[model samples]
Target: MELQLALDLVNIPEGIALVKEVAPFIDIVEIGTPIVINEGLHAVKAMKEAFPHLKVLADLKIMDAGGYEVMKASEAGADIVTVLGASNDLTIKGCVDEAKKQGSKVLVDMINVKDIATRAKELDALGVDYICVHTGYDGQAAGQNPFEDLATIKSVVKNSKTAIAGGIKLETLPEAIKANPDLIIVGGGITGQDDKAGVASKIRDLITQG
Candidate 1:
């Protein structure tokens, strides 16, 4: 399992500082959708430039022009890019093809997909690098989580690695770990804490112990 720290609410400089604090513990640094929307792929470039050792994921959550957007993100130094699971198969295929050409990887985000099991199986056949089960902010507010959805994908997905995100905190991480996702994504769970680095370190330790 790997730890991926999601930088959703922070700007470029703040995001960089936060990542620097937990860089040793995290395997991937995610430039989240909100930050990408606010700061552009320059945020991805800057994060990669600052922490060359860590894998940088650009959360494009791309819904269209999948190949072109992923290509741009790859050019900007992103190691992985996200596309929505709800997108048409052709769009998902476009992302995988372009990511291969760019020497990058694609993660399909199953944020709001109604039939996660069915979609995950199809995406696995499509050759995506990772199939992520994500509970969006709205869903989180409604007390939804990706744990059950993560299990749904884990059972059905044969080819692609699995990831889980949204509202994952230290108290809840052990449960998430039991599911054995390839990647565990945490945003405010770490950043919102008073002791960010300490929290991240503990979370890393938990992932390691698992």
Candidate 2:
């Protein structure tokens, strides 16, 4: 499994620093939606500069103009860009097509989708590279978890890559990893605390080799 550590809300300097510490350990570095919205594509570019070896993901949460968003994210140095699963089929398909032309991957994040199973199947048919079963940070604070949602989506979309995000901490990782998700995304659990490198190392050890 690939471990993606989400660095959200940290400024450019802090995000770069955290990546410097954790990039060697983790498989991907995510420039989260909040951070990207604050810093612009410059955030994604900066992350790519900080660690050229690690894959960069820009969580744009794109709801419209999928082609333009995918082009911008790819040019900004995002290997993978995300579009909301709640978006219309044409929009999602546009993003997927644009990503293909740009040689970048597209992830359809199922955050507030009414029918996750139905949407997962649609994304699978559209040739999306990844399906992210995510609960927003606000939802996390409200006691929502996508772990079970991950299982439900996984069952429906058996061929595509799967990822889980939100409220992922060290203690909760083992269970999430056991789900055998293709990627495990962590946001506040690592970036909101001290020892960013240590936290990443622990995640790397627990997920990939375990």
Candidate 3:
């Protein structure tokens, strides 16, 4: 399993500094939806320029015009672009096709999707790179998580790699590892901690051990 550091609340510079601290432990540095909205694709480009070796994900949470959005994000140095699972099949296919052309990837975020298993199966068939079960901030506030949703997608998604995100912290890292997702996403889990590097390092160790 690979660990992804989600940078949602930080600015571009703050995000860069945070990544530098945990670079050794993270496989992907995500320019989260909020940062993307505030800084545009520039956040993706900045992160890529700062750390060329680590993957940069643009959390566009795209709801429409997938091909165009994915193309723009790819040009901005995003290695992976996200499209909502609730989107049309054509939109998802557009993202997959465009991402393939750009040598990038499409990660379908299954947040608020009513039927994760069925949608994951369809997205997998559409050749998405990753199917992620995510609980948004509001959901997380309501005490929701992606664990069960992760299992739902894991059962039927055959071709695509699986991922889980939403309020994942060091304490809960073991539970996420037990789910055996290809990618594990954490935001406040590491970012909110006092010793970011220490927490990230420990999380990485757990993932490696798992």
Candidate 4:
């Protein structure tokens, strides 16, 4: 399991500071949807500039204009960018093609997709790098669990990598790993804490143990 540390809703400088401190131990660093919505491609560019050696994912949550958004994220130096699974196949295909052209990866977010299994398979066929089984922030606040959701999504994805994102605490991390996903993503739990490096290390240890 790869640990994906997410910086959510923080200012650019603060996010970069955390990245500087904790990125060495993490496999992937995500610029969360809230951060991307707030700061746009400039935020992705800034993070890339700050951590030139680290892998960068722009969680743009592209629900529309997927190709344009993918292009923007790629030009801004994102190693990976996201498109909603609910988007039309053409949109997802466009983003995937653009990402391939830019030498970046594409993550299809199945946040609110009704037929996640079908969409996931479609994205896999379209050649996305990963299928993110994400529970929205509001969904988590309402008691949605990513472990169960991830397990189900994992069983459905044939060839695409799987990433789980939600309220991932240490206790539930083992369950996430038990699902044997390709990657695990966490945001507020770590970013909300004061000790970023510690949180990053703890997550890495869990991934190792898992």
Candidate 5:
């Protein structure tokens, strides 16, 4: 399993600094939706420039014009770009095709998708690099999580790697690890902690032990 640190509420500089603390423990640094909204693709470029070794993911959650968006993100040095699972298949195809040409990757975010298993199967066939089961902040506030959704996608997704995100903390990480997602995304779980590097290091150790 790979650990991904999600930088949702931070700006480019803040994000860069945060990643530096836990860079050794993470495989990917995510420029989350809020940061992209606040800083544009510059956040991706900045993160990539700061940490050339770690992969940078631009969480665009793209709903349309996948090809163009992926191209722009790739040009901005994003290694992986996200597309909404709720989007049309053609849009996902566009993303996959463009990402391949750009030598980048497309991670389909199944955040609000009504039928995850079916969509995951479809996305896997459509050639997305990763299919992520995610519960957004509102869902997390309502006491929802991605653990069950992670299992749902894992059951049906055969071709693409699977990922899970939202509300994943040190206390609950072992439960997520039991499901065996290919990528485990943690935001406040590490970022909100008093000891960011310590928590991140532990998270990485748990994943490594698995």
Candidate 6:
């Protein structure tokens, strides 16, 4: 399992500082949707420039024009870009194809996709690099999580690697670990803590143990 730190609530500078604290513990640094919306793809560029050794993901959560979006993100130095699972099959395929040309990867985010297992299977066939089970902030507010959804995708997805995101913290991390997602994305879980590096280190240790 790999640990990904999601930088949703921070600006580029704050995001950089946070990642610098926990950089050694994380495999991917996600420039989240909000950060991208607020700071633009410049966030991805800055993060990549700052931490050249770590992989950077631009969470475009793209809903259309996948090829163009992936191309732009890759140009901005994104290692991976995201597209929504609910998007048209052609859009998803376009993302996969474009990512390959850019030497980047695509992650299909299954946030509100109603039929996760069926959709996951289809997306895997579409050649996405990762199929992520995610719970948005609203869903987390309603006490929803991606653990069960993660398992559903794991059981059905054959080609794509699996990932899970949303509100994952040290307290509930072991629960997520048991499901064995290829990538575990945490946002406020570590970012909101007082001891960011300490929390991130522990989370890294847990993933290593699993």
Report the C-alpha displacement of residue 91, candidate 6, in angstroms. 0.6
lDDT string, candidate 2, 27-88, tens digits: 88999888988989999998898788899999999899999999999998999999999998
Question: Over the full model, what C-alpha lDDT does candidate 5 score relative to the true structure?
Answer: 0.94
Q: What is the Å distance of residue 163 in model 3 from its true position?
A: 0.2
Model 6: lowest-lDDT 10 consecutive positions: 151-160
Worst 10 residues of 2 by lDDT: 187-196
Off by over 4 Å in 2: none
Where does model 1 exceed 4 Å of error? none
lDDT of 6 by residue, 1-210 (tens): 999999998899999989999999999999999999998999999999999999999999999998999999999999999999999999998999999999999999999999998999999999999999999999999999888899889999788899999889999999999999999999999999999999999999999999
lDDT of 4 at 41: 80
Q: Which candidate is the best by lDDT?
A: 1
lDDT per residue for candidate 3 within 1-210, as digits (tens), equals 888999999899999999999999999999999999899999999999999999999999999999999999999999999999999999998999999999999999999999787888889999999999998999989999888888888899778999999999989989999999999999999999999999999999999999
> Total backbone clashes of model 6?
0
For candidate 6, the per-residue lDDT at 21 reads 95
Tell me how candidate 4 scores on lDDT: 0.83
TM-score of each: 0.99, 0.97, 0.99, 0.94, 0.98, 0.99
Tens-place lDDT digits, model 1, residues 1-210: 999999999999999989888888899999999999999999999999999999999999999999999999999999999999999999999999999999999999999899999999999999999999999999999999888899989999888999999999999999999999999999999999998889999999999999
Clashing pairs in 1: none
| RMSD (CA, angstroms), candidate 3 | 0.6
* Candidate 5, residue 185: lDDT: 96
Better model by TM-score: candidate 2 vs candidate 3: 3
Q: At residue 6, what lDDT does model 5 achieve?
A: 96
Question: Model 4 clash tally?
Answer: 0
